[model samples]
Target: MAKVSINLATGSIQKEEIIVGIDLGTTNSLVAFINPDKNPQVINDTGKGVLVPSVVHFGPAGEITVGNEAREYLVTDPQNTVFSVKRLLGRSYHDIENYKDFFSYKVIDDDSESLVKIKVGDKFYTPIELSSLILKELKARAEHALKTPVNRAVITVPAYFNDSQRQATRDAGKLAGLDVLRIVNEPTAASLAYGIGLNPEETKTIAVYDLGGGTFDVSILQIQNGIFEVLATNGNTFLGGDDFDSAIVDYWIEKNQLNKADIIADNKLAQKLRLKAEEAKRAFAYQSLVNDKIGDIWCTLDRNTFEQLILGKVQETITCCQNALKDAKIEVGQIDEVIMVGGSTRTALVKKMVAEFFGRPVHDEVNPDEVVALGAAIQADVLAGNRSDILLLDVTPLSLGIETMGGLMDVIIPRNSKVPTKAGRQYTTSIDGQVNMKIAVYQGERDLIKENRKLAEFDLKGIPSMPAGFPKVDINFLLNADGILKIQAIELRSGVKQEVEVKPTYGITDDQVEQMLLDSITHAKDDVSQRMLIEARVEGEQMVKQVEGFLRKNSDFVSIAEIADTTKYIDKLNAALTSGDKDAIHKAIDELNEFTRPFAERLMDQAISHAMKGKSIE
Candidate 1:
């Protein structure tokens, strides 16, 4: 890392210092720099001397490629090639189905809860490991290009990535030997990419519509006098251009009458089809129609047809924007400007949709794709004291709550609440002689226990076995600046302190991160990948079984699927239960259940029916 001197009094630019901002994206990863003169540039890591493609490939002969070189392998070596790996980064095997159509290799349930292990050429690597490879390659590119070690950087993640995922991202940065200064939200960073360049004291409200290769986010930000406050943000970490590309592929498949086989059945065909779809999508962004012939089928797709094919998916992306506005409690009309970010936002249809939603045209001053990386660098400047005019106030996207009586979720801190916030819950023993108190932590808005995510569990051990009604414990849940949770429990009577367990769920644990780093270097290639995949698959099955059972038991009220379609996926899952391939199991599990949907309205309807059916004594 290079150090540069700056004049604090006047906020004037000074000498040159090298600080890189890294956008470790799902479908692509890039490193950027802000020179001493405030001239920003994105470093090229390609074979042709450009940005890396964030794709990785493995072969039987210990051969590998990165950047553009590895990207071409999608067309050349389908079975062993991997792309959009960022989708798997910090996500469980259960989350892989959103992009499973594009992954050439298979995913297995690794033993880790937060890890997805890919099996390829008799080997396996967690998405984190693959991410590190890309990050390391980017680091190397930065150092090699600058002829200096690139140790310090800022990384970006989807606005919706939870604390665990964000931590995993930071862990990947450390694995790559980079000092990840901060993990900024992709949309927030893009705001800074432009805000920092403008004169201070100007108040601007921007609604960021970010549709990336593998994730979608909508962020509402308020910038005043250079202070960037993220009012509200929401997104689907699993939704992105990848789905649109798959839609195109599905279009080709359906048009060509190739429904005879599963898309995953032929590695080569899946890879080629994805490539063709991506090309057509890119072309259709400008031209009315894209004449693309690259896979098992040939087709000419007009922009109108392409837009219609992805209308639902696109609506889902816009829904995120709508959700963000609702979370912010701000109306769309109040937004000063609408900014678009990410590679997939280039589509004219996307622009049209956004314009219609906001009832205004989007600001296209900054390139949607590179704005995030640029904003990351700007934040890096702020953290390093290069710029003092800016201050950012961010909020946690999910509510923090604890399980209550009857497995109901009692929320402590609501979503979009400012960080470094504190809340406490006073819990008393329920029975006559309750020895231990179980406080299960959860995230999400659902009042039902099973519907929410179990983050961790705290046990108040070594009680005097006193009467349950007499014993009391106060559990304090505090969220720090980094959005990491810390919990503490104090016994009111005895004054004895119970252990505070800040254990994380749904993402890689700290121990796993440390172990992964060592294993990446020492483990035999094929074995590690195999182990990770198996673990991922099993967990995926677990998720499937739980959600599927819930769906079947309450079939009448589900907004999820038509009865026939729902049963079909369930049958497919049943068929895959015996399959040894963890990836397939995981993929099947995820495809069946996704989104924060309110399932089986009949549950509520049943409650009301029961109440109504009981005749009033009056």
Candidate 2:
């Protein structure tokens, strides 16, 4: 049996669950909580610094290491070490096709819109799984420091993160054995940490300039009546302090006349140079010049040259700030305050440029690396009914979503979202000539639809038949004041529309909701595994059908031998699917794709030739 108490004034939960705030970063991550004195502080367990290196290493015998312990593997065994995984979260292979070389590890690319996966040795892992490992580390750290069970958390993400990315973060937290209370925006959390919007009567418009290790983002925000609204956000996901380090590396490489290819081939030399570059970057902050050496190679840098090297990258952030302000429909003078966040903000150049752009002194009173986490702690405390001075609106207890491909629940309205809200996402068909899409709505916290409760379902018919991934469909969920959910589906290309209304709480009881939440947390691993298997099966089936269609329609252009091989590969894939082994199915899918790619290309060439027949070159 459990107890539940609600605060009538704030509409929050008054319980003993100690929810911590987590700032999961690209280069580092940390967890924080509100101290007994009602002040937020970062957990420094056993004097082991606050920052946890966002790196993981896998041993040969199924052993794993995270944080600082795993960082050494980045140089010793780049193939087994994973870093900067935050950039890959919720992104498809096509989204990062141009930047795949950035990672030293193998990122599997099947030339599809599916979520990206990483391969270390023989096993494959998703970004969500890697991120969960980091979260698990943080959870352990928090529990060790606070001497209490920390099973709930509020995680921060970039303001520009879309629904998919936010959902991915939530899923990672769930996988880490934590109930993700909320997904707070990084800029918003920074504002709270600086006490910029604590006073209910305070009204201000501010800019949060965050430049982390591997990402940069600037957001314009408006705070009124204790409500923070993001006006605009813009930044380059691939631009940040990492770029600065690379710039230094490139400068040294050119100056030393070192072969870039040779440096990449030699791991020790590459790591040595990278470390030296980092040291120079930090030294230039207070010293006029920095001099170092790696064996016989001299690494020398002065502040002037160092600044010049990263000047272009800094200018890019400035441009993004300008664009963010423009999108917010405000001028630099209109901004009340500027907040600096992320370790990169410690650079004098970054501060000076940001100050000059906003015509104000940037706020750096709090530690940039820990600000977001601290703010998250404050939000968690508020949610725990520790404060009544600030009031929060009602929120949904569980996530509401629709059944997507492979019986996966695609959450449209996440748990704890403020009621009377509307959110939507655009989706495309996975099969060609598909005219109807079945919309199965579900309500619960699990990742798989089988574990959730069905509310209602309907079909959006009469879609224009086209190639796969052609027809764009937008799904929207609107929850009203009375908790009535209205789901709408619209096909943008054909102008077709369908909608349905369902009472989510019609037959559901409070005890049932509580059970669902507990089950979601208790069986999180099983739920995620099942979801992944189903997704793999769905993708394999789609690939099998597409390959068969290609062979049938273009038999005249493709070689008979190629057709035979592709057919055999498809049969193997179908067999694997029936066996319910996700890895085996994926392997077969990869083989079939590799064999048919050339055949498809040849067919494409023939079609082009036929279309251009008798046409003038001019």
Candidate 3:
């Protein structure tokens, strides 16, 4: 850690810091501290602008200013003042494909793996490290502004950050030497900012559509009394106002017929034009044409041009909204108020779209950009155990499941099921004479296991071998109130158990989860669709094979006619599996399980009777 120095006529050294609430965002950041009455307040630097741009500039002398002071340097030092690096935070290089268009800076490619390295100096830094730099600056800002030691703070992150990304944020806080009280979700915090102030009569279903500098999130919540339950959340971690800026930049750059080579060669022109375009994009939300001058560059940007450039991107947000509604299983008309958060949502086009979609006005009182920070501070207050009445119950955004017989996803905890919810799913051996079964846990909304993010794996090997498919194994998934996942499993027959303790992995695990995956090289291409087909076929094959093996092993135990009926169903499944026809295999599986009903019933009856005998004596 370095000290902030001041030169008074000649030279000086003053060390001080203060605890703060920081919004470590993609484009901007701010430091907030408690006032005399312990109310959270932003530590404004004389001018009274509470919000700080998360950009940083490295001068020839290595000096830095976080907000407006650093902002002026964007046009001056075009190569420095890293903006929107939050887009790269906790994200993989592969995930970047869906988001790279939002950034104006060039992405430095990594040759080794899926890690993304951005070109900064004659150097490159990982997004986590870069994020730490921004976080450290916030720490220093609060410290220098308050003249007290800043040792603790709370930070906000996108709601959808998987396990790895969440960990990265925590790591960033730690690297900066601040005790990150909790990593609260950006939109969730905004909702808290709005909901905590309302009365019991103010019960309403609020949807938060936050489009910040480099991220977009839509959260549907039911705030009754004081209980804030998040029903559903969906968003592209990369969608935001930054993309809108890029759209304007792309339009202007293309209109002038410039290429990467031309822009890189003329750094000042590029920076000047980008800043102008971004300002125009922001201004178009209020006025039709934003006329501005950047150095010698003059431009009058209009709403029509901005709209035309971003119609597709804007539509993508609509698609995200639709999917979020679907995930929540609610209609637009059911929403009470559309609370818009983030600087980008101030756009007239975005407002019109939201109003048209929900037939309601937006909660315009709370400043979109500042609301999250305020909400975060409130949550920090609660986590500090100050606000006892307010308890936040958030859901794990994705479903969690185990890999079944084949590579198919067998979901235990469905999406939006509620926090601290536990689900148990029983599995049977796919093969006869099998003593051990391995459970691979995953999380995601995808239908296939490969498509989902693998959380962890546990193996139960002490089960007794009867024949093939004799043991019953139950997998239990426990998602706590904070949206973190925990899992455990036990073999019913032998009581053999294994519990999976999920670790704090990098990128918040998902990058949608990077480490949860078995191998990037193995399933990156046919991850989802292929896994579904294979799983279906394997299930059918396992069912059919087990039935045949059962009949052969216990020839005289069952009637010939009964065996023949089950055998016919097994034959259908076997043939379908061999032909690689998923539909037929699925149908055959149902039919085969149906034919085994009587024997299954008998087995259940016998077990019940045998267990009741002990209870009678007691």
lDDT of 2: 0.89
> lDDT for every model?
0.70, 0.89, 0.67
Best by lDDT: 2
lDDT of 2 at 593: 80
- Per-model tally of clashing residue pairs: 18, 0, 25
Worst 10 residues of 1 by lDDT: 519-528
* lDDT tens readout by residue for model 2, 522-588: 9999988888788889989999888788777777877778777777898899999998777787778
Writing each residue's lDDT as its tens digit, candidate 1 over 511-611 gives: 75445434433332343344445554545556555556667676666654565676677677766666766556665665565321334444776787888
* Residue 521, model 2, lDDT: 96
TM-score, one value per model? 0.62, 0.94, 0.57
Q: Quote the RMSD, in angstroms, for model 3.
A: 18.2
Model 2 ranges with Cα > 4 A deviation = 1-15, 428-434, 465-469, 606-618
Q: Rank the candidates by lDDT, best first.
A: 2, 1, 3
Scored against the true structure, residue 615 in model 3 reaches a CA lDDT of 77
Off by over 4 Å in 1: 1-17, 46-49, 61-64, 74-82, 92-106, 110-124, 196-204, 224-229, 250-270, 291-298, 391-487, 490-618
Residue-level lDDT of model 3, residues 243-275, one tens digit each, is 787777776666555685777578677676777
